[model samples]
Target: MTVDSRIIYGSWNLEEPTTPTRSRLFCLEPIGLGTAYVESLTGYVARLSETHYVETGMLILTQIGPLMKEGYTFDGRAGGIDKLYGRYTRAFNGASNWTSALISALEHLTLRHDLKFLSVLPWVEVIPLRYLLRPSRAWCPVCYQEWKDAGKQIYEPLLWFFDAIKICSNHHYPLCTKCPYCQKENRPLDWYSRPGYCSKCKEWLGTNQNSIQTDLGEPLKSDLNWQLWASENIGSLLATAPSLVCSPSKATISMAIAAYVEGTSEGNVSSFANKVGIEDQQIHRHIKGKTFPSLKTLLQLCKHLEVTLLKFLTEEPTVEDLARASARLPQLKNSTKRESFVIRHNQSSIELALKEALLENPPPSVTELSKRLGYASSGPLYYHASSLSYALAEKHLDYERVRRFEKMRSILESTLQKEECPPPSMQDVARQEGFSVQLLTTTFPELSRAISDRHKEYRQMLKTVRIEKLRQEVKEVAFQLNKQGIEPTRTNVSNCLSKPKSIVMQAAIEALQEVRHQLGWEG
Candidate 1:
């Protein structure tokens, strides 16, 4: 019997189906996506490096650095790598140009379009970079330990990167800045950083199993409530990012504040400012869309206005809701009575205070004078006694210049005299003293040069030491393989070493040849 030709030819359209291109790297999904605890872009990079069995710095230098178009390049040398990882890594999680470039590079590598959600890039238009991100890493030990115990991936969340997020909303404990073992703060992304481990010491950062009941020095009830509110609201904002039809704008924020001002204070900005504890001029600037409030200030505004941060940015309050919110303004004003206390100062009292301040030794700063005069800031003092305020400020600046110079000189001379091993670099001293390396070099060129020279010598010594240790390790591994009747080949020797990645293959090959010669083996 013949088969039916219709069965073979039925619905045969000879068009080739289009297959999507494969990504170069694994497209690992970010943890807690669409939630406040979403994994940070830096955290995602660290995890990706681990998956590929390469150092994070190496991955960045090899794969992502070349893809960046904005002249963001990493030096492959050790010192340059250290500088990048130690000081410049914080920008990876922020809304800077580097963050945008890295996101584009990673998306190209992973072929995933959703990587921008891992950073604050989506909100860059409305969020100012100043005071936005923390300089160092912060984490909740309880959260780390809990995730570890549950065998969950211990990635850092984007929420912990915010400078405003001091406490963990879920754990209600203050986030830790320094490592428990090393007592050293770590950068947001280190060269060989791993999740749940100290980047410097490689020690576990999670809470100890036996110290589960340790006191965390909880804050007062009122302060704790505010911290919780700020953290939760900020988290809500991050969680709502993926679903936003359009990014939040300054106009939207301005309209919201303007609406509130009209409703609560009947278009009286000063009255509304008094209720909100923000300066009227600052409120005016915000309403005019000239500038945006910082994240901390924005959170405070939302809390006092009885609106969620997500709603305040995304939706405008209706007239009725604003009326109800305004009705509660009386209670807010009453509650802030202590904060709204106005200090009455006349012209005579201000002039008398300035005269006495001028004669005082170790002249007080304008800010100090303001506090002593019962004014909130130096603005009022300058307004009333312009000449006196200027003179006082100049004197204080001169004094401070001499004082700071002496302090920095003493610290630099002391650092040079110290007999510590692995001498600290100029960058280290600058970071520890909260000064910039450029400032130090410009101010004290000789001392900065000496420090740099000493650090270079120490680094050379370390390199010599590491080379010797690596040779010894390679020799040992080669001998062991030979004794096992196996060829001391490079691959075999490397596989036998404890840390195969730490050995330089050329050094290992040379050591293997020496071992083979010692064993009376032919080449």
Candidate 2:
């Protein structure tokens, strides 16, 4: 595909489809002033060495170098370049400066031949080499070979603009420009510095509100509609890009994963690396070797993968999938569950160490137990203790909570063997069985302080509920007395209260219910 240099010159200044128009093309527009013009497709930019300052210089050479011989006209120049020197040479007043410009021109032209001008901002996107080709001139950055239809040429400025956005110093919203804590650290480039925190001793103290947002200057967001659009378009941008490699795989998988998990395409190996606190190279090496990461590395992987490290490094995932999982894992419960698991694993491990120690002449102390077991601190043992506490409470194991539950079971069995029916009241049952209500409440049934508090609340509600039931029972008993030709009124109930014995209350309640049933007043 030979691009006629003359065609470029003719279209250069025709009427740019965009502003900040290709200045290099503007410089050559007049060289084809007398030729028959071909009005380019609306957004076509002239053969572009890319929009870089250096590439523009190459376009100046290709567009002007040949035209200069016949005496090219001087005109369309933007932002100071070569004079229309005798053609281009005559315009230069001094030999040294002209030679310097000549050298810059040659150097630029050489570089443009292989230049892969990336069109992107902080995160870059490489412009396709095809979009950048021009057979007669340098290449045109605007001509995309993968056009939807031959006749309807649409140039996605946003595509090019985002590249510019990534590299530009001005867009301040996706990331803040001023770190309220440290004014020095908020550019897009600063993102790699640290998960930035405020230097100012504010309440957040070492915290950052780092949510990526769109640039405020943007009138609309591409993200809202880009999902479906990307379903069609990302394939073009993603086709086997080297930067996208996750081992031998193209970046599409990483990008697809990030979209699924993070609801965006911000996933790439480097982004994963940053979260894991390992250089991308290390992760590449680990996965490339078909190896699993160490435990610490596993946790880091989980931070971004949104899975536990065990699942991440294991051959087959063991999922404990549930909604509100994020809520379930506050530091307290997570640490607690972790402590229990660690304690159980360690306790089994510790028993082995103890057996070995007992084989020696002198057994090791509890402190030495950890050293022999290769544990870093006594904290692991303490973590185990906490684990036991929960197990004892839930009665899940025959440990603490289980011991109390069983003890309570034993007492109830013994009392039942001795008496036909103990009174149902809490104090009466305790008194008859030689049990202390306080000890029973606190120990054998061992409700933790939290459970005790919860019970207190339940007791408050039960106070009203229990009192009403008791009153109904008393009424039935009194009615039974009346049916049997004895006084059974609220006033007569004082005698039962005065009698002071749970057995008396029991007899009264049973008789009342029996009488109430006969009277068609079910209790």
Candidate 3:
């Protein structure tokens, strides 16, 4: 069952016939598509190296060969096997599904006429072409009669060709009747039979739990585990005067102060208001940078300025989410008139260079370099300029905003060193972290949003753990939640731990440590 490509005829073998005398690209009955592949492989060469072995091995897997031999789909009396058309990258070490997809795509491309045409549709074409064809086979008279005459199981003759094969009977249930390989000796391997015997070899499923995430990556962490969003730029932003990000309601005030610094006269302030979208009178009232703008309106202004949506986004997305989102991008429309569609990617070099040039310009403010990007306004535009800087920077990828625990990090480091005072309030932690006291009560919308998610995740975790017991007996479960300063109420606990997202777990640990000090817990 080891796949050795050089031992097989390989690409050339797949192309030219083995012999002019027996030369024809056709499937014969009884021999099964699996047999044809085995013939092609064994007749190609004695053996090959590991790299070619996996590469060529993949080329064979996608076709459903053994099933093809027994007539699961294609060329059989009972046909309809799935045809694989495209490939997904394969893991050479193992991962039969991925290898199968890769091989299927390569073979189909090689066989199909003008497959080059599909290359133009790279995004769509990349999807694995699963369910393309059924297995079909050719049987020689000798292979057929000897198979029938062996007095083996009716399905035994295919032993010469396939590995993971099962012969489905033409019955109402349509289940596999027997193993094509062993014929009369054994029943075919069951597909989903885990921790059970293989239908062909009657052994365990690969003898490994390749069913989990950590196992897929040999280095474990290298498999893109949800990474911590501790970017260098995040440190820079957090270091800025905390006053830079006050309550959202005070955004108009901040903008007014920024305008004042720009020397916008009172009369000119009205003009600035009209340029963005807001009341001129409101701007005059908040000119001191004390009042905030509405979170929704601030986002709208930022978007119109062509800024990174990070102004509105937080809670770093996980690797799984990113993968899912990226996968969907290939399948969706590229652009829309209202907003650039996520699918519409691949920026032009010229346009990217233009953005870089603008960012590198002195004073780098939106209005200062308006001509660089061809914009008319300067007010409420500097944010967009910063966004352009991120977009043009190759190493930096601007995605969902990630929350930086400036305060919790300090507190944890201090507390871990056993130097902190006892029982700090949640507000104390926020204040220590440079957030306002209103943060816990949802006053600071961002902090509140994060807290709400925490509550949900906490509750969910508690729900999954069934600890129905009297108060005294509930020590184990109650003690566990209490260690983190969490009440054991089904509602509160469930709400706190409801998310089950790894990010939530990480954040909650930090948040609860702050609570632990407040609860006066030494442990």
Please write out the lDDT profile of model 2 over residues 387-465, one tens digit for every residue: 3222222232224335566766676545434433312333344556665453455464433233334434555566556
Candidate with maximal lDDT: 1
Q: For model 1, how does the per-residue alpha-carbon lDDT over 187-249 read when each residue is reduced to its tens digit?
A: 877777777888899899899436765444645344778888887887887798898897876
Question: Which 10-residue span in candidate 1 carries the lowest summed lDDT?
Answer: 332-341
Each candidate's lDDT (Cα)? 0.76, 0.33, 0.30
Give RMSD to native, each candidate.
15.6, 37.1, 28.2
Q: Write the per-residue lDDT of candidate 3 for residues 385-468, one digit (tens) a residue.
A: 324433332122111112234444444344334433333434345556664333233334454444434444554545434222
Which 10 successive residues of model 2 have the least lDDT summed?
A: 114-123
Ranking by lDDT: 1, 2, 3
Q: Quote each prediction's TM-score.
A: 0.61, 0.16, 0.18
Give each model's clash number: 0, 20, 55
**Backbone clash tally (model 1):** 0
Residue 364 accuracy (lDDT) in model 1 = 91
The TM-score measured for candidate 3 stands at 0.18
Give the candidate order by descending TM-score.
Answer: 1, 3, 2
Error of 3 at 270 (Å): 3.1
